[model samples]
Target: MRTDLLILAGFVAVGGYLFSQVWLSPGDRILAHSYNDHYQFEWFLAVDTYNITHLHNPFFTDLQNASVGVNLMGNASVLGLALPLLPITLLFGPSVSFLLAVTLGFALTAFGWYWVLHRHLCAHRIAAVLGGGFAAFAPTIVSHGNAHLNLVSMFLVPWIVRFALRLFRTTRPVRDSVILGLLIAYQALIGEEILLMTAMALGMFVIVYAFPLLPDLRTMVRPFLTGIAVAVGVSLPLLAYPLWMQFAGPRHYDSLGGLAYVTNDLNTLFEYSTTSVGNLGGTLTSTNYAEENGYFGWALLILGAGLALWLWRDRLVRTVAVLGAIGLAFSLGPDVGWYFERTGVPGPWKLFVELPILDSMNVGRFTFLTVVALGVMLAVATDRIIKASADGGVKRAGVPLRLVWAAALAAALVPLVPLPLPATGRPPVPHFFTSGAYKQYIAENHTVVPVPALKATGDMTALTWQMATGMDFRMPEGYFMGPLGPDNIATNEPPPGPVTSVLLDVAKTGKAVQLTSAQQADMLAELRKWQADAVVVYRVEALPQLRETLDPLLGSGRQVDDVWLWDVRALTRE
Candidate 1:
C-alpha cells in the first residue's frame, strides 16, 4: 500500500483501539453527571419499548411524555447524519444501542473528515489521515462523548469547512451552495444548537468573501435560496419535537442547574479557578500546553497569518483578518477574559447577544471557533506551501522546513509511546456508588408497583428499574397530587399540589396535616378535595401537614404504613 494509505489505516486502527480501551469497558456506564445516564439511557430504553409495543421506532419524537417536557431524538451527526440506529435498539437493547451509536459515530466522523480534507485542500492522503485521526482522538470529543450526543456532532465540522472552501475557490456557486445546504441539514439532525453556531460562523465568512462575486448576485441568490430551502426541508422532522415543546412544555431551554449556573456578575467568570488544567489523565500542571501544542497541522494557522501579512496591502486579505479576529475574540470569554470583559461588549459580544441562536455559544468555549479557524489557516497555508515547494525544493530553502517536520514527528511520539503502554493496565474508573437495595428491590418485584423509591441515592438506572418495579411508569401521567418539583421532572411528571390547598375543605385538616411554609395551601386543599387514599412524603418534615390533616379523617384507624408506602386509602371516604 502507499505510505499515505498505510498511515490513514493506522490512524483508524488507533482510533478503534483507543475507543475500545477507554470507552467500552463493562462498567463504563455513568458519565460525569447522573442526568446523562438517566436521559440518554431512558431515550434508548424508550426506543426499545416503542419498537416492541408500537412495532416502530419513534426517532422523530424523543419527548417520551409530551405532557411533562421535551426531549430531542439524537441522530449520529457524523455519518449520513440520520437516526439510523433507532431500529437497532430492538435487536440488541440499551447497552448495545449506546455501544453501536458511539462506534458508528466515531467511524462516520473519521471517514467524513478524511473526505472533506481530501476534497477541499487537495491534501496528500497522510494529511487527510492525520486530520481525521487527530479529530477522532480529540480529548474534548472523547471526554464529552461519554454521554453528550452534541459533542459527537463535531464530525460534521470538517464537511462544513469543505463547503466554505468550495465557495471560495470556484465559479460553481450553484453546486457548492446546494452541497453546503445539505451539510447544514445534516448538522441540524445531529444537534440543533451546534448546527446553529456553525451556520452563523459560515454565514459571516460568506458575506466577507462575497464582494468579488457581487456582480453575479442574480446567479448567487438562486443557489443560496435553494440551499436554504433544502436545509429547512431536511431539518423538519428533528425540529418538530423542540418546536412543540417550546410552544407547550415545562423547560423550553436546556436545564441550567449545574456548573454552568453562573451569576450575572462578571467577577464570577474570572473567579472560577477550574479553568487551567485539572487531573489531565493524572498530569498535574499550572499551564495548559499540550505535549505537542498546535499539532495535527498548525502549519495552517501560520500560513494564514502569513497570508494576511503579505496581503496587508489588499482588501481580500481582510476576509482572513476579520475571521481571525472574530475567532480570537471568541476564544476569550465575553464576561471573564480580561480582554473580553472590558472590550468585548461594544463589539462582537453585542452581536452574539442580539442573536438569540448564538445564546448557545457558551462564552468560554471559544475552542470551537479556534479549531475551525485553524482548519482554514491550515488549508490556506497548505495552498501557499505547495506553491512554494513547486517553485523551490526544501533543500534549496531559506527556512528549515524539513527540520521542523522532524521535530513535530518526534514530539507526537514521545507522549503517546509511554502513555498507552500495554504493560500498564487499562485506565480505571472507581465504582464509588453501588446499590444492594435496588438489586434486591428488582429481584423481589417482577410486577410494577406504585411505591416511591427509597431515599434516591446513586445512579438513576439503579433507581429507575426500582421505581418502575411496582407501577407501569408511563410519561405524561400524574399519580400523586402536588406541584411538580425538580425530582418529579426526572420521572417525567409534574409536582403534586400544595399540602395546604389539598386539605382546605377537610374538617379534620388540622389533625391530618403537618403544614410547612414551602407546601402551598392550595395544594393541600386540592389533596383534601381528591379525598386521597394516602399521601407519601419522603422527608419527615413534609409529613407533619399530612399527619395533622389526616388525624381526624382516620378516627380510630391511624394507618400510616411508612414514608414510601403511606396508605393514603384511609384519607378517602370509606
Candidate 2:
C-alpha cells in the first residue's frame, strides 16, 4: 500500500478509537472549562481569517458590527493556531477542520516518535510503531486535549531532533538554521510560555551534542548563529502583537517565589491514584504512582532499564545520559522536595533572567522531554533485543508449519478470547456552541458576528482578556476577572454600540450587583451620559431595568443581528 493510504488508515483507526473512548460517554471526560478555551481558540482562528482579510484591523471594535478583524478580541488576535486552521478550513470546511487538525497533529506525533527511534535503531519498524503509539495516546495528550495547543504540538519534536542531528553531522548552517528557526518561531507563535520551555530543552540538547563537535568550533559556531538568526527572522511577524505583552500584560504573580505556589495548584497532584499498575495517565495530574497506575508505563520502565545497561557498554552513552537526565529531572521535579525549594525560595539558578522563562513554563509540563527521550530509548533497546534474538540461530519457520500452528491456536481459543468489533456511533454535537444563545444566531445568520472598526462605537465587554490581547483590541481594556474597573475607556468616547449588558461591582461588595428598577433607570442614565447605545443589567435584579431600557431601544432600532442593532435611525429607515 502507498504510504499516504497507510497514513490515512492509521489516522482513521486512531481517531475512531479516541472518539469512541472519550466523546461518547461520561466514563472519560473532564469539565467543559478544561478544553473549552482551546476549542474556542480554534473557532477564533476561523473567525480571525475573515476578520483580517476584509477589515484590516484585528479587533472587534463594535458589538453591532460583525466584520472580521475590525473589532477582534485583542488577546485572541495573535494568530496562534490561526494559520494552521486556515488551510484545514479551506480544504475540508469548518465542520471537519478541527478533527483534521487533531488527525494531522497525532499523525505528526506518531511520525516524530518513528523518526526519533529510527535514528537510534537501524530499521526496527515494530519498535518505532509501538513507541509512536504510546506517545500519540499518552495520558498528558488526553488530559490537555481541550486547552493545550503547545503540549499537543509535540508532534514537531521528532523533526527538530532529526534536523539538529543532521546539522551536527553535515555542518550546513543555512539549512539547519532555517528548519530550527522555523520550528522555534512556530512555537513562539503558538504561545510564549510553551515556546520558552521548548527553547530551554533544545538549548540543553545542543550543549550536550556540542561536546562531540568541539574539535571543530567553526562548524558548530556557524550553524548555531544561523539557527538563532532563523529563529529571529521567523518570529518577526509575531513581534507586532505578543512580545511586548510579555512584560506589559497584567501579571498575577510578581516574583519567582509566587510562581512556585501559583503553578503547583495542589489539587492537580492528588487527582489520580498511583496504584493503577502500568498506567501512564498521570502526566496531567501528579497522582501517586501506586494508585493511578504509574505515569511511566511498564514498557517504558523496561526500556529505561535496558538503556541503563546499554550506557555501561556504549560509546554514545553520553547522548542517552544527557537526554535521560533532563527527562528524569522534569519527571521527578514535582514529586521531590528539593526541586520545590530550588524552583522557589531563592535557589541558585533562580537568578538568571531565563529562569523567569522557565518559571513561566509552569513545572508540570516538563514531561515532553521525558516522552521524547523514552521514544529514543525504546527504539534503540527494541532494535537491539529483536536483532540479538533473531540472529541467534532462531530458525525461520516454514510457511506450512507457521500456518498450521496459527490455525491450531485460533481453533483452540476462539470462544474464550473473541476479537471484539469496532463500536458504531453518531457524529459529535458541538456542545461548545449549542448551549449558548449565540449559537442560534450563528446558525440563523451562518456567519460569526462582525467586529466593528476602532473608529466606530462598539462594546468590548463580550471579550475575555486572552482573546482581547491576541487581537490587540483597543477598546475598554478590561479583564474578565480583574482588580481594576473599566478605567481604560476614554472619557469622551462615543456610545460603545447597543448595550447587551454591563458588569458593575458596586461598593466593592463580594456579592454581585443586582439591578433593581431604580438601578435600571440609573444605569441607563449613566450609559446615556457616556453617549451609550443601551443600558445593560448585569444581574437578575437588573433584569427589569434592562427590559425597561432595552424595550425602548429595541422599538427605536431595527434588529440588525441577534445581540444589538446598528442604531434606531437605521431601523426606522429600513
Candidate 3:
C-alpha cells in the first residue's frame, strides 16, 4: 500500500476503536448530551422520512415546535448530512447511521490534514501523520463528540487550508480557488460555525505569512482575491436561499445569552478534562462537559512554546503560535480570570460582543484552533529533529536529536490521549406510537398534544414517537429551536403554557402542582387555543395526578395500550 493510504487506514482503525461500543451495540440508546443528541438523531430520522415520502419543503415542518413550527434554515438542520444516509437510517435506524457518520468523521478529518501536511506543508511523512492525529483526535474535538456532531465533522477545514495555500504556492491558483469554493459550500452544509472559525484562522495565517513577502504579496494579490470571489460565487447556489430563509423567515429568532458562562479561564488552558489521559486531569480546573475544550495538556503546550521560541523566524511556527494565542484570548469571552479568581477584566471577546453573527457563536469553541496549532507545531518540531539527526552537523552530546524529540512527542501524546465516549439508556417509546397506532388518534391536518410538553431536562418522548410513526402526525411542544421571549433568542424547546409547565413538572419530578380555579380556567383556555386534535400521555411517573388535574378541563380519557388518549377536537373547535 502507498504510505498515505497506510496512514489513512491506521486512522480509520483508530476511529473505529474509539467508537466500537457505539457500533457493536447499536440498539443500546446513547447520547453525548443528556438531551441534545437524542433529539438531533431523531430529527435526522424525521427529516429523512419526510424526504422519502413527500415532495414538500423539508425546512418548514410542523412536526416539531409545533403550531407555528420551526424554520430549520435558522437552526442546525443538517439536511445535507442526513440525505446521503437515508438508506442507512431507513434500514438500521438513525442511531446506527449516527455512529457510522461519527466514526467516518474522525477518520476523514485526520486523513484530510495528513494529506495537507505530507503533500503541502511538511516533507516528513512521520511528522505529517502525527499532525493529522492531533488535528483530528484532539481532546477538544473529543470533548465536543459528547454531543456536537457538526463540530466533529471537520474534514473540510484542512482541505480548505490546503487549497488556500495553493493560491500562494501553485500556478493553478484559479482551479484551486474554484475547488476551494465548492469545499466551503459543502462544509457550510456540514457546520457553518466551524467553517467560519476556520476562515478566521486562515485569515490570520494570510496576514502573518504575507507581511514578510510584501512585494511578492502585491504580485500575488490578484489571484488570491479572485479565488475568494470565485469561492463565494460557487457557494451562492447552495447557501443563498437557506441564508435568506434563516434571517427573513417566520419563527426565526436572534441569538442571546450565549458564551457568557462557557468561556475558558486562563488556567483552563493548563488544565485537562477528566477524560484526558493526563496527570492533571480533573485536578487543575473544570468546565461543563461540552465546554471542556480549554485544555491542550501541559506537555504539548510547553513543548509548543519552546518550539515557538526556537523558531521565531519561521513564518509557519509564528503564524500557528499567534493563532493559538488569538484563539485562547478570544475564547475567554469578555471575562478575564485565573483558576479561581475573576479579575472582572475584559477580554478581546468583548469587542465582538455586539458584532452581528459573532455574538451568537460560542467563543469557547475557538479553543479548537489552539489544539490544531499545537498539533502542527508538534509536527514541525518532529521534522526539525529528523533533519537535525540526518544532517549530523547539529547534534547534542553524541545523542541524535531525532531520538530526543521522538521521546518528547511520545511523552506529550501519552498525557494527551483521550478516553472513549460511553453510551447511556434511552427512555422507552410505546408500541402505540412506534406501530403507527397514532394514526387513529391524529389525522392529516391535526396535531397531537403530548401532555407535559417536551423539555431538555425531561424526556423528549414525542420526538422519538413522531420518528417511530414515520412522522405521520405533528406534535405540539417538541424539541426544536424557535422564537422565544423579549430578545427572541432561539429556544430549543417550545415555550410551554402554564398548564403544560405544571404537567411537565409532574411528569419529570413526580411532584404535584396545586391548581387554583383561575389557573384551571387559564389552562383550559390555552388548550382550546391550540385546537388540538388529540392528547396522549405515556410512560409518565405521576400519571394519577396528571389524570386528576386534566379531568376537570377535559372529561375522562380512555386508555389504549400504554398511553391515555383524549380526543379534544370537539372541545377545541367550540
**Top candidate by lDDT:** 3
Which candidate number would show the highest TM-score if scored against the true structure? 3
| Candidate 2 structure quality by residue, lDDT tens digits, 1-574 | 3653575468546644543333344212322422133334444564555455556434333222222112233233335455667676555433244444544666677766765665454547766765665566544344444344445555666665565555545556676767776775565555554456556676777777566667886767665556676656755664645444433433212223332322222232322222222222324344211111114543344446556676545534456556655544553333343313333333222334255345433454555555555555555555655665554543337434334433532332221111111122222222323334333222222222222212212322233221322322222222111112243321212333323233323212224344467656653443333333221122134334333444553353223223332232222223
Clashing pairs in 3: 32-146
My TM-score estimates for the predictions, one after another, are 0.60, 0.61, 0.92
Taking the tens digit of each residue's C-alpha lDDT, what string does model 1 give over 199-276?
A: 666677677766667888666656665655554565565466645644334333332222221112232212211111
Worst 10 residues of 3 by lDDT: 279-288
- The 10-residue segment of model 2 with minimum total lDDT is 413-422
Task: Give the deviation of candidate 3 from the true structure as CA RMSD.
Answer: 2.6
Count of backbone clashes, every candidate in sequence: 58, 48, 1
lDDT (Cα atoms) of all candidates against the true structure: 0.41, 0.42, 0.75
Question: On residues 197-257, what C-alpha lDDT tens digit does candidate 3 reach at each position?
Answer: 9988888888887888888887776677778888888888878877777777777777745
Q: Is candidate 1 or candidate 3 better by lDDT?
A: 3
Rank list by lDDT: 3, 2, 1
User: Between prediction 1 and prediction 3, which has the larger TM-score?
Assistant: 3
